[model samples]
Target: MAAKLFSPLRLRGLELKNRIVVSPMCEYSSQDGFANDWHLVHLGSRAVGGAGLIIFEATAVSPEGRITPDDLGIWKDEHIEMLKRITSFIESQGSVAGVQLAHAGRKASTSSPWKGGVKVPEDQGGWQTVAPSALPFSDAYPMPVALDEAGIQKVLDDFRAATKRCLQAGFKVIEIHAAHGYLLHEFFSPLSNQRTDQYGGSFENRIRLLLEVVAAVREIWPTDHPLFVRISATDWTEGGWSIEDSVALANVLKTKDVDLIDASTGGNVPNARIPVGPGYQVEFAARIRQETGIPTGAVGIITDAQQAETILENNQADLIIMAREFLRDPYFPLHAAQELGADVPWPVQYERAKRHK
Candidate 1:
């Protein structure tokens, strides 16, 4: 039988009621790493609206790993309480809750997009960013400190600790953020990673840290819960991290217990040309999934019901993860189910809204 968008799919022991996953979109609404009512309502509304899985934004594994200091964090045990609340409400709505664990690395300490997203100064809440090499994201950004071997281990330890906190917070899926020219992407792309150590240089050396981080995270995360790794399928620049490289990395990740690759591209370089449009990045997901035989999530500009259904119908990806679309219509899954003539339960409170005259 062909799998449809509304059909349940299981990865490891985690069962998603449908193919629609709310991709992690940063709210930038946290205060001191604590989730608040904004998160509660933001996540809960999506679950109520009928997304099969709701993934929280790229949450930092350590204080310095945050893109902006105001970004969400799970570096401490105290951050778990509010996250649990959001998860509990999501599960109540019959949606599985997932969280993307991230480390911004050299890309850390920028102003929020609303606040111009420029390089924040040290006194004004910015801190020293670290990366595979001493290179900064841009001349406007701080010159990052190269992570020593011990520092690299500390980052891995942070990811491990964050995974433990995620389990306590009741996240059913844990996604390691390794894409978008953040810390991990910095390592993968030669444009940013110019180093002589084992963590950088050739393809194998450059990809080493990310593989190690995944292994460390998998050790702490439960075998029953799904583990996903988000990767930039391409750096979208000449002589940069290419889709071919991503395919090879995905193949390696499969053996490391990575359940899915949330395939999205670009973020490491500034002002690189990206051919953005509807389903712009889906091709990368399709290629990676086909090349590696790994369950992959297709994200970026996936809006319409027909487009999403086609993605699944063609086996382009195992899951369709929507971002801005879900924000625009929290009930997108229910509306899509109706539009595509698929059976999906409407929230009982809104059952009257589902009538056909």
Candidate 2:
């Protein structure tokens, strides 16, 4: 049977109602890293709208790991209570809830995109950020502090703590954010990591942090639920992280029991030209899945039903994760089902709008 966008897929012990996953997007609305009604409503709508999986935005594992003060946190037990409400609502609508556990690294302590997204000074409520090396993401951002052995151990513990919190919140899947110039990405990309320590330089060293984090998280995470790792498949800069490096890394992660590789690109460098268009980054997902024989989630500029279906029918990726388009239409999976002529349940409130007419 040809795999379709609305097809049910199983990874590990979880069965997705469909292949459409609402990608984690930063809402920048939390206070003190707590989830609120805004998150409940925002994520709840997608579950009602019929996404098989609802992955929350990049949630920091620690305060200093946040991209902004408003970013969601799972570092503390208090944060888990609020997240539980959101996950319960999602499950009520028959969707699996997932959380992306992340550390922003050198990208931390910035204003929200709407607030201009520039580096916020300490007096302005921004704190110093950390990275594998004391490098600035750009000249506009402050220099980051390099992580020592103690600091690195602290990071691993933070991730372990966050994973325990996710289990408490009833999340079935957890994605470790190693993409988008975040802490893990910084360590993986030589373009951002200029250190000569055991944590950087050679490919083995560059991947050390991510491998450790994944192993640590997997140790605590339930064996039944899926585990995903999002990676910027390429830096898109000359002499930077490349597709080949991603393929090699994907192979390594597969050995660590990672269930899926969410393939995305860029964000390690300031202004590398990315060839943006419909399904622009899907090729990276396809390549990695093909080369590594690991399941992958294709993301980036996938906005329509046929486009997503094509990615699946061609076996380019095992799943499709959409971001901005899902925001524009939360019930995107339901609508895409209609467009693809597949049977999908619509909210009873919206059942009258089904394609029968």
Candidate 3:
């Protein structure tokens, strides 16, 4: 019997060679949202490492949507060429290229984690952040401006435009960043959203913006390509966005033609106590998959080969997405195949290092 971890899985027109996915991690190396050598090497090495999918980190759909000044962006036409170069290399290595279209919302204007991660003031080139309400993420974060009707429309438009750019860059998959208390998550979680308007106050209203963004992106995204939505599943606090809310949202997303739910959890609040451990969030993925009958990708602390294989064999998730693990070992898939006694091909140039059983 073969390990399910190395099994091929198809989503829409894209057929992954294996179930291992390189989850998007912020490199914070770009200047004005441009992809440079650092991005090329960072992502290219993973493709060579044999990941079936390589999702570029939270790429902002507009200038103000960036999490930091150094975050990647797809807000302009000039950004396409550089992204195209990167995607071409990924595909050449037999890895499907994907980008996470995102808007940081209230989390915008912060410095990169290395630079103390503080919020940059408006006078110092940072713009005022916007959210469903005027609340700031914390005292250290800036108070965001409440997005009115026009502002909301702008967000939708930005997503649509960004989808077009992703296609132009030859990306095979698109994942909407609705997780980790970003713009979309902020709107969906009751903890952060307190508006009484059409886009707030109730479950349906709270998810309105994300639904609208998905619908807009779907309109521009080709039918052959797969679309993914990442959600935090739970806010881990009372009265916050719960796993029940995530299931309901997943059902709704299936109706809108979403391919998979990247089930992650807990980034909507500043002080929610989360029980973080190895495969801790896998239960959320399993429940959402079983309850909604939607394909989900399990993330968070999934570090071992057997753990990933068990999740797939038990039918918990269809895809295994790993972040920090990939950072630690860029060739995780190649190594995992050896550990599981699966014979997966290594990059021809690096075949000298291939293990002999």
Q: How well is each residue in 209-280 modelled by candidate 2, as lDDT tens digits?
A: 999999899889999989999999999998889999999999999999999999999998999999899899
lDDT of 1 by residue, 1-357 (tens): 333989999988879999999999988888788899999999999999999999999999998999987799999999999999999999999999999999999889888889888888899988989998888878878889999988999999999999999999999999889999899889999999899988778999999988988888888888898999999999899999999999999999999999999999999998899999999999999999999999999999999898999999999999999999998999999999888888788988999889686
Question: Candidate 3, which segments miss by more than 4 Å at Cα?
Answer: none
The lDDT of each candidate is 0.92, 0.93, 0.95
Off by over 4 Å in 1: 1-3
Instruction: At residue 50, give the lDDT of candidate 3.
Output: 98
Sort the candidates on TM-score, descending order: 3, 1, 2
Kindly give the stretch of ten consecutive residues in candidate 1 with the minimal lDDT sum. 1-10
Query: Candidates 1 and 3: which is better by TM-score?
Result: 3
Q: What RMSD, rounded to one decimal, does every model reach?
A: 1.2, 1.2, 0.8
For model 3, where is the 10-residue window of minimal lDDT? 348-357
